[model samples]
Target: MSGHACGSLRHACAALAVLASIGAGTAAAQQISPAETLLFETEHLARVRVPATLVYAFRKESNVEPGFKDEVRLELAKVNGKLNATLHFLTGVHKQDIPALEEAHGNPVLLGFLEHDIAEMKRLTGGSTAYFRKRIRMALAEGAQVSLQPITYQGKTVQAQAVRIQPYLNDPMHARFEKYLRKTYTFILSEQVPGSLYQLHSSLGKPETVRTGTQPADAPVIDETLTLISVTPKQP
Candidate 1:
C-alpha cells in the first residue's frame, strides 16, 4: 500500500544521480546513461513493503550443457526502518553463499543476477572473470540502448523502460569465445511492478536460435531469464 504505481519512467528521470555508493563515478567525471542510472543507482526495491517475498522464476536452457528450472528468492524486511534484503541466488544443492545486501540499496536482484551470470560466462567460455565483469559494467555505464515500453502489472498497463546491450561484440578479446559475440541482454523495469524489475533476459547463439525461451532447452542455443513471477506478504 505504500508504493506508487504506473509511472516509473518519470520517477527514474527525477531520481537521477551518480549513486556512487554502488560504484557510479561522479557525475562530473563521465557521462552515465539512463540504463546505468536505473540499473545501478535507482532504489528499485524501496517501494515494496517490508516482509514481502519477491519470487523470480529463473529458467536457463542450453544445447551445449545441462539446463535448469529454478528460482531466485528475495526476502525483504525492515532493519531499523530501512529496507534490507537477503538474496537466495541459488537454492538446493548448488546454493551459493547467502548475500545479505546493503541497507536500502534497492537493487539486489540486479546485483545478484549479474554476479551469477559473470561466473557462468567464465565457466563456459574459459574467459577471465575480470574481462566479463568489466565489459558488462562498461556497457551499462555508457553503451546500452534504452527505450520506452509498456508493461502489464496487476492487469493494468504501465510505463516501463527496456535497456538492451551486447557487451562483448566489440571487445578486443572477443574472439576467445567466437560464438558468444552475439550475446545480448534485455532488462525491463517498471515502477508499477512490486520490485521494479519486470524481467532480465539473456540470449546467446544465432539470431534464429536466440529467441528460444523458458520451455525450449533442446535448441542449439542458450536462453535464460529471471522473470518477476510473484510477490506476496512474507510469513512472519
Candidate 2:
C-alpha cells in the first residue's frame, strides 16, 4: 500500500466508475439502492487497481536524421488517493534523485486504512445504503473527478462539477494533468451473476502521438499506434 493523496486525478479517476455504472441501475436498485453504497464498492475496487509503481519510456527521433532516444521511468504510490510517492528517472542515470522518490511515497495511516476499507467493500458489496454511502463519501472526500457538470444515472440525470488542477498537467508533455485533460468515457456495469455486476466501457482518453526529431523544427513522423487496453473484473 503506497502512500499518495486523492486529488483531482484520483477524483477524476474515481469518477471512472460512473462510466461503469451505465447498465448498473437495475442491479443497484434491487440491491444497493443508495447511490453512496454503489459508489463505495466502485471506489474500493478502484483503489486496489491503483498502480503501486508506473514505468513509461519516451524517445526523441528526427524525421530526416533519426538516432537519439530518451526514456523516463516513474514510480508512483498513493497518499489519500492523490499521487504521493513518485520517483522520476531519466534512464541513463543509475542513482538519480532517489531521495526525492522516497519522499514522494505515501502516508502510513492512509495505507493502513485501505486494508480495512477494502474489507468493508467486500462486506458491503451486497449490503445496505448507509454503509455504501459512508465509504463513497470517504473516497470522494479525497477529491475525485466531479466533472461532466452532471450526467445521467439510473434513469435520473445528475450533474457533476469539475474540479480544477494545474493547467499544465493537462498537457500530455507535462507531468501533472489538469482537470480539463481528462478523457471522455461511457461505462455500463451489469450483473453477470445474480448479485454481481461486471462493468465495461469505452474510455475516451488522449490518443497517443509519436513524433520523431527536434521540436520547433517540424519533427518528422515516425510511427503512431493507438491501442485500447480493456479492463476485466479481476484485472481491476
Candidate 3:
C-alpha cells in the first residue's frame, strides 16, 4: 500500500530542481522532442483501501508548461462503489516540492511547516467520508474558493478541478464535518513517443545509488495499448 504512492511526494520534490535546470537549458530541451518519445517522471505517495486515497507527483514533456512541473497531492474516499477525490496542486510561485526542498536543505521552520501540513492531511483523511466531511466542509466553508476547469484525458473530456464532498464524508465518526476536499486533475496527451520513460535510477531503499544509465525496477510499466487509450488533439 505504501509502496509507490508514499514515495511519490519525496521523489517529486527531489526531481523539481533537476527539472527546473532542464527547463532553463536549451540543450536539455532540445534533447527532448515530440518525435523522440516522451517520458513521464512520476512518484506515488499513499494508497487507499476503502475510501482509499492515492497521490501522484509527476512532470511531463508537454503541458501548459512544457517540461511542465508541479506536485499534485490527491486524496480519494470510496464507498458502495462510488468514488470521490480531492486534489491540492502547487504550481509556479505556490509550488510545494521546491519550497519543501529549500526547507529540507536549510530552513528548519519550513520543515516544521511541511510536517504540520502533512499531519493535517493525514488527520483529515485518516477515516471514512462520514468521519471527515463535516470537518472538510467546515474548512472549505471557511472562505476557500472552489475553482473548476475543463480537461480532456483518455479521449474523454471532463471537468477537472477542485471538488468538495467525497466518499467517506458521511461516516458516523466524521459527522461533525460538513465537507471534504475532492478533486482530480486530468491531462490530455496525443502522439506519445516510444521508449521515453521516467524511471528511478536508484533508491536508498535499495542498494543502488541514483544512476542515469539504467532503468529503475520501480518504474511504471505502461502497456502500449494503455498509452494509446483516449488520446485526441484539436485540429490546427
Candidate 4:
C-alpha cells in the first residue's frame, strides 16, 4: 500500500475509535428490537450480488480544484451462505484484497470502508440504525439538530436521515489535541429494498490539512459520497 492509503486507513481507524468511545457510555441505554434482529439476520444471510462504484474526491482548498479523483469497484456477494466483499481500486495504488467473510451481527448492510473483521466492518459501515441512534442521542445531548427528509440519488429517491454534530470535544484531557470539529452525516436507504444501503453522504467542517499535516495551508472542507450502482438479487 502507498503512504496515502496507509494514512487514510489509519485516520479511519482513529475516527472509529473516537466514535466507539462516544457510544461506550450509552451502550447500556440501547435496545435491540426483534424486528431489527430479523432484518439483520435476513440481510446478512441473503443470496445477492451488489456491484458498486465508490468515487472519492479530494479537495485541498476551496479555490483550488480537486487534488485527485479515485475510483474503486466494490463487489459484495454471498457464497455458500457466507457474506463477503471484494474491493478493487482501479487507480492501482493499492493491491486488491478479498476480506474474510464473518458473521454480520453488528452491521448487516455493508456501507463503510472495507475491512477484514466484523468489528472493523461495523466501524467502516456507518449506516446502521443502531449506530445512528447513538449519534443522535449524543447530538441531541449536545444541542444539535437532527432531521429526516426525502433525497434522490442516481435517479432513485429515498428517505434520508441526518444529524448535525456541533464542534464539541469529549475528552477533557485531550482537548488540546482535539480540533474544533463539526460533522454532518446523511444516510439514504430504501424501504422497498431491505438489508441494503442505497447511499451515504458525509460532510466535515474542518479541512483535510488539519487532520493530515500535508500542504494546502488553509483548511479545506471534505465531502464523501458512497452510492450503490446496482444490485442483482439471487433467487432461492
Total colliding residue pairs, candidate 1: 0
Worst 10 residues of 2 by lDDT: 193-202
TM-score of 4: 0.49
TM-score of 1: 0.80
- Ordered from best to worst lDDT, the candidate numbers read 1, 4, 2, 3
Candidate lDDT (C-alpha), each: 0.71, 0.29, 0.27, 0.38
Candidate 2, residues 132-234: lDDT per residue as tens digits?
A: 3333333333333433334343344444323221222223432221221232212122221111112212121221332222232442332211111222222
**Where in model 2 is the C-alpha error above 4 Å?**
1-51, 79-82, 85-89, 92-219, 222-236
Question: Which numbered prediction scores highest in lDDT against the true structure?
Answer: 1
**What TM-score number comes out for model 2?**
0.23
Candidates in order, TM-scores: namely 0.80, 0.23, 0.21, 0.49
Q: After superposition, how far is residue 197 of candidate 4 from its true place, in Å?
A: 2.3
- Give the alpha carbon lDDT tens digit for every residue of 8-45 in model 4: 23332232332333435542344432322222222432
Q: What's the true lDDT of residue 107 in model 4?
A: 30
Clashes of 4: 2
Better of 1 and 2 by lDDT: 1
Deviation from truth (RMSD, Å), model 2: 17.6
For residue 131, what is the lDDT in candidate 2? 34
lDDT (tens digit, per residue) of candidate 3 on 1-236: 12221132333223222222222333233332221111122211112232332233343331112233344443344545443434444456545432322101111111222233334345544643222223332222222333454544435555533222232333344443323222211122222211111111111121121134243555322110011111012111
After superposition, candidate 3 runs with Cα above 4 Å error: 11-99, 102-168, 179-236
